[model samples]
Target: MARRGGDDRTLDLLAWQPPEPQRYAEERVRTATLRDRISRAVSETLKDCEQTRADVARAMGEWLGEDVSENMLNAYASQGREEHTIPYLRLLALVQVTGDTRLLQLGAELFDTTVIENRLKPFIEIGMRFDRRNRAVAIAQEEDREIDVAIRTIRKGARQ
Candidate 1:
């Protein structure tokens, strides 16, 4: 294929094939509200933690340089206390203290996104590049089809 007048040589997009889809752990379809999810995450993380609620709160307070009382933590984790939502920074501190990244993953899932370790980001980037390449090839083929149709019409007009 001839190179375009750009820095990179044009690829033969027509010959390109898309990569196979990858499957990860499938999450069950949930009907819970965000508020419920947040409350559940806080409760679950606390239950799994070795530290007491007071200790977790103290660590969170220290991490944020603010007063995070055990009562406040309880309120944040209480499903009935819809108004007592955990602040973003407080949630971050809680995750840091408990090392429960699912708290962040819950939020990411709301936007159809996933939370992954830093080490795996390059592999995700590779998949993204493949998606981009597939889109480019599709667009190029469409443009080529339009050009061919136009050329055919002009040739028929000249023959008449």
Candidate 2:
């Protein structure tokens, strides 16, 4: 038998409905929204140290020498707020106040990127090899997990 390949029309015809695809699409959009992700990251970072909005606001005000109220900070973390993006300086302050990089990491992960400190841009290429090494280590970790899972399954089957 020979198979013929067609374009968009064929794909459209062959696509499966699989019940409520629209619902899945809507949910994906809801969850993947950048604003929502940032807000969630802020909330998670706060939760780690058992801090409240007021605590953050007070700490930030003291650290930055500005008056930031609890309501303003709460609005930033809450959904559908105008301040979807936190200022870079404020974000730095958040890192200092919270003592956690989760918020910055979350924003970077959401965009499939990373934040690395660089003192001199001209000398920054020297760090590429180190970054590649880190990537290799990550791949090795994933391989180790796969091997562990395989061994566990094999032992379970032998017992059965």
**Residue 71 lDDT (model 2):** 74
TM-scores for all candidates: the values are 0.70, 0.48
On residues 12-73, what C-alpha lDDT tens digit does candidate 2 reach at each position?
A: 53443333111112232245577776666555555565677689879988999988777776
RMSD of each: 9.5, 20.7
In order of listing, the candidates' clash counts read 0, 0
Where's the lowest-lDDT run of ten residues in candidate 1? 20-29
Alpha carbon lDDT of residue 11, candidate 1? 85
Give the alpha carbon lDDT tens digit for every residue of 24-65 in model 1.
223421326878767767887888789999999999999999
C-alpha lDDT of all candidate models, in order: 0.82, 0.66
Q: Which candidate is the best by TM-score?
A: 1
